[model samples]
Target: MSQEATFKSIVCEIFGIQEGDVADTKTPEDIESWTSVTHMQLVARFEESFKFQFDVEEITEMDSIASMKNVLRKHGVDL
Candidate 1:
């Protein structure tokens, strides 16, 4: 699957939501399941699936799907 597809799948699984709900503009404020603990879980899952470690700053910057895409792109991820 493509990186974007994989990303949406992960987010859907993590947030217990449907694929249609995972949008680039969605943030923690928009998702009830996106708590602090789940946010770390997301970071771990993303790092594991994408094979890249995110530094503290990048982790903090990932407040939304769009921001996560930016950080992943900075790490040379194609999507």
Candidate 2:
């Protein structure tokens, strides 16, 4: 699958939501399941699936799907 598709899948799974419910603008404030623990779980899952490690700064900056995409782009990921 494409990176965007994979990303949505992971987020949906972690948040226990449907694919249609995910959007780049969504943040922890929008999703009840997006707690601090699930946030790290997302980091771990993204690191594993994308094969890149996120530094502390990047981790802190990833409060939304758009931010995560930005950090992935910085790491040379296309989407």
Candidate 3:
């Protein structure tokens, strides 16, 4: 799979949602399982999925899938 597809898969698996249903606008407020603890889990998922760790600011800026992709790219991740 492409990096984008893998990223979506990780998000879908972490949030218990369908990959097809994911969008750039989706956020914590839009998902029932996206609680504080789950947010940490999602962060960890991203780190593990991409094999890179995010700093505090980067973690906080991961508000949506679009932002996440942007952050990942900023960190030199191709996705």
Estimated TM-score for each candidate: 0.93, 0.92, 0.88
Best by lDDT: 1
> Model 3: how far is 21 from its true place, Å?
1.9
Error of 3 at 42 (Å): 1.4
Better of 1 and 2 by lDDT: 1
Model 2, residue 74: distance off in Å is 1.3
In Å, residue 25's CA in model 1 sits off its true spot by 1.3
Q: What local lDDT score does residue 64 receive in model 2, on the 0 to 100 scale?
A: 87
TM accuracy, model 2:
0.92
Q: Model 2 Cα displacement at 33 (Å)?
A: 0.2
Rank the models by lDDT, top first: 1, 2, 3
- Return the TM-score for candidate 3, rounded to 2 decimals: 0.88
> Backbone collision count in every prediction?
0, 0, 0
**Residues forming the 10-long window of minimal summed lDDT in candidate 3:** 1-10
lDDT of 1 by residue, 1-79 (tens): 9988888888888889999888889999999999998899999999999998999999999999899889999988778
Query: Best to worst by TM-score, what's the order?
Result: 1, 2, 3
Clashing residue pairs in candidate 2 are none
Q: Which residues of candidate 1, in runs, are more than 4 Å off? A: none
Relative to the true structure, how large is the alpha-carbon lDDT of every model?
Answer: 0.90, 0.90, 0.84
